[model samples]
Target chain A: MSSSEMTSPEETPLLEVRELSISFGGLQALNQVSFAVEEGEIFGLIGPNGAGKTTLFNCVSGLIQATSGVIHYEGQPLDGLPIHARSLVGIARTFQNLNLFHGLTVLENLMVPVEVRQRRGFIADAFRATRSRFGESQAREEAGAILHLLHLGDLRDVMAGELPVGLQRRVELGRAVAQRPRLLLLDEPASGLDGRETAELGALLPRIARQLSVTIVLVDHDMALVMRVCDRICALDFGQVIAMGTPAEVRNDPTVMSAYLGASGAVQVAQR
Target chain B: MRFDRQLLVRAAMVIGAFDVLYLLADHVGANYRRLMTLSAVDGLLVLSLVVLTGFVGQISFVQAELNGFGGLLAGAMIGRLHWSFWVALPLAVVASVAVGIVVGVPALRLRGLILGVVTIALALAFDAWVFSLDTFKAQFIDRPSLLGWDLSDDRATFAFCLAVLAGCAWMVANLQRSKTGRMLASIRDAEVAARTSGVDVTRAKLLAFGISAGLAGLAGVLLDLTIGTADKQSFTLLISLNIAAVVILMGPNRVASAFAGGIFLRWGSEILDKVGVGGKYLNVVLGVGLIVQLIAAPEGVVGQFSHIRAAAGRSLRRRVAAT
Candidate 1:
């Protein structure tokens, strides 16, 4: 048995990806990439555009099937599971492009995951029975709490699509958090945010990881936010992991520096 | 709960308006009363489209086909099997729902124009083969006798159909506020996002189709009873396209829109007839109306009205504050 397989239940990683690989028609998107996210840690995946960061996130969340790999969540194999099934098993994700439901209100957007996690049946919903009523009320309350946590309580009734892009990203974060998942995958949560908003998010991510006790795998191109927020960082270049270590170690790595800045340039790391 | 008062007022207004219409139909001639009844049945059919197309963002041209299936089944159960209306009604709805699930299973792999084509194919098949079956060719379908009072009376049947429409509207309104409804909207907005959030997109899609089919089935039975005949010609593919046009023209988000679409579907032709306009002219009007609405108000007539109302309210509040 592998060392990872021999880990006890209590010490098992929250998420383990082994030799994951996926290729498009003629181009390889990800190649034999592997990583393990510990519980309650803010892990970061940093790469330039087309480095397959989003693709890796998609594979972990089961939105895209890996060409070859084994993903174990909490020591159980997650092979062949559908996206919703993975979500039900406590895997929640936010899109790189904000995917908030445009037709629904902000509060209703947050309630989507809560509703999915609840136990209301179709018959109950059709009849407007007690179970359905109670479940909806509970979902609303939970969503309200999440909105408050994200400091978006005032915009609860606003249409999601009508919100600013920065606010939309926060709403998407709230939606993923509302799932109450053990593992959360956020794709480019700071992509479109201004510096102030990105800084706020940088502080918020670690606090969320600590307070909620949830593991987070964040993929973002924002170097400063990733360096400040993430405990460990994985830098990928052309679908290959170039560095995986503490944020400082990744920042100092020659390959990561060369990948970010061209080979001729001297590495000068910026301090946040 | 902030909108509770508004909701109550809207509900009261709707009920009062329908009550006034009921009284007006009572005083009017039988032809007018029959028109109103048919309009209510059409309202239910449009509501099915509202749920499927408006809320779930799925375009289906098979609603009329599902309606035909229900009408045929209800006719068989009542005319041949000697079943009561209550028994036959539920059976017909359930059967249509089953067929909806069957169609929805294959439809899961299809979306947008392809799905529309598949539904159109289903509609054509029903029109060509299913309706031509000897068993579905019932001369007359008997109406139910409720509480020893024959519902064959025009006024009573009108009231009954009105009540059914009201009940369906209320249920759909309630559904829009429910969790399932939110999930459906999410699926419509972003299927991948909804799936990542743990929503069973396939199940939600199937449920949307099922509810739509069941509602269509109810509308079919009511239409058959109102006309006092089971004519297959009444549910042609052209009728399906016409209903789609009406729903799109009038909007499908609100039950009021569906109700309005039904009225327009029935009375628009009547008005054209009264004006000595040919039936083909009515098609031109519908086609033009659909194109105009799509370009100017894609949210539909009722949705645009609400937007205007909200804007007006905001301006009024601003003026009051300024004063």
Candidate 2:
């Protein structure tokens, strides 16, 4: 067998977006964008502001419907599923701005997603059945484990809003991890972090991908961290893919250099 | 285990307070008993607000209308169909929940003040059209006699109303600590976050509405029992506004706070009536209280009490250190 076949014999891309387009009134937010993310790969989506990176993530997570085209996950069409259904089917995400539940504690924030996976109904909960308690304890244990893994064990009881931005981001990441998702979408995870915190996150992402065997799709403006961590990268300009390849190949591409600098400066950067 | 201990302490305090009130009513006279019974029913109604406005952060102005629907159904079932109180109560609650879902599903598209507007319109419609129907007239109710005891007896009815209030309070407490409650709270704080976390946002909101409406329906049955009639005036749009005002003034976080709100709403009005001010002035008092609550204690009276307790503890600790 070939080396590619040896790695993944049943090689089916985890996510495939085809000719997706969405317009807000007269302006096109995303214009016929398409890409495929393979299993267990740390795929990076990098672009300047207003390049429609978040808009694409929203479309993939089912937060907003695309005006046209199809999205396939695990080889099945994700046409009519709602946001929660998409999450249940192993697609979990975090927001660019910290969207942690302000009323809940760090532990409680993690438990919210875990509790949703429990089978106990509201009647069972209201009645305080043994099954409900068992489900609750299980969720708590899962949340605790994720907290420990993320080094947030000490801040378990801290209100999410009281935490600093770095810690809040960690809590959001821990929450998504607690869901035990097969695919995780993170929007600007390194946006508010200092250099040290960004480095820690850079190391943490690959470790998470390796240990959990989870594919990651990350959108961010941190080029240094993105180049170091992501196995493959896709760069966008004007809601269209300008370059898509391995990190080294994308970095060498003239279009990417021009997109970052300017059309005239691409040659100078490439020469250097 | 810590959670259980806290819950146990809260339960004991609530039951003990109710016991004291019950004994006091027994000695004071029928007038006091009548007031306490109304307060108990109001307690249930405020709890409906606790689930929706407090936990889910959905402002609704139609709780009284939902309460009226329950009373109307109870009157029809017990009076016309000759059904027992036990049979009519659950049926009324279920029917009210169905109506709540119908209203709640569409209201989900709107948020904050807009949703409040829709609910106000609904309350007006219920008062002007639904409650005025001939079938729901106050004369149609029939008080049930359960297990050799007639609920028509003032003392028996008071005790029965207290019992129902206790059950509802216990259930509300249980729901607050459960996963369902956490999910609802999450939605309240952040809807998009809750949705991305795998919570069915629509379903959670609908369930909150149903539970809120169900509690109001249960209160309606008790209200009808207390008065021995289904008085449309008691469940009017103005009454709904008053109930919402009370919840805002008393805090909606804990079940005990809802009970406290109910007592304050009922007895506060009685005090004004005794002073020759009458029930008409009660709304003016509530409006002033609501303003004070917003400015001084946005978390409401119960939350303010906790803050005071915390401050006192800190001061005591500082004094000990200084000495």
- Which candidate has the highest TM-score of all? 1
Docking class of 1: medium
**Cα error of candidate 2 at position A160, Å:** 1.1
lDDT of 1 by residue, B105-139 (tens): 76688889999998899899999998899878865
Residue-level lDDT tens digits of model 1 in A28-120: 998888878888888889877899999888888887888888889988999889989998989998988889998899999999899888887
Residue A67, candidate 1: how far off, in angstroms? 1.5
* Local distance difference test, candidate 2: 0.87
Tens-digit lDDT string for candidate 2 (B141-213): 5667888898778878888888888888777778888899899999999999899889999999999999999
Best by lDDT: 2
For model 1, the DockQ equals 0.73
Model 2 chain A scores worst on lDDT over the 10 consecutive residues at A1-10
Each prediction's whole-model lDDT (CA): 0.86, 0.87
Question: Model 2 captures what fraction of native contacts?
Answer: 0.76
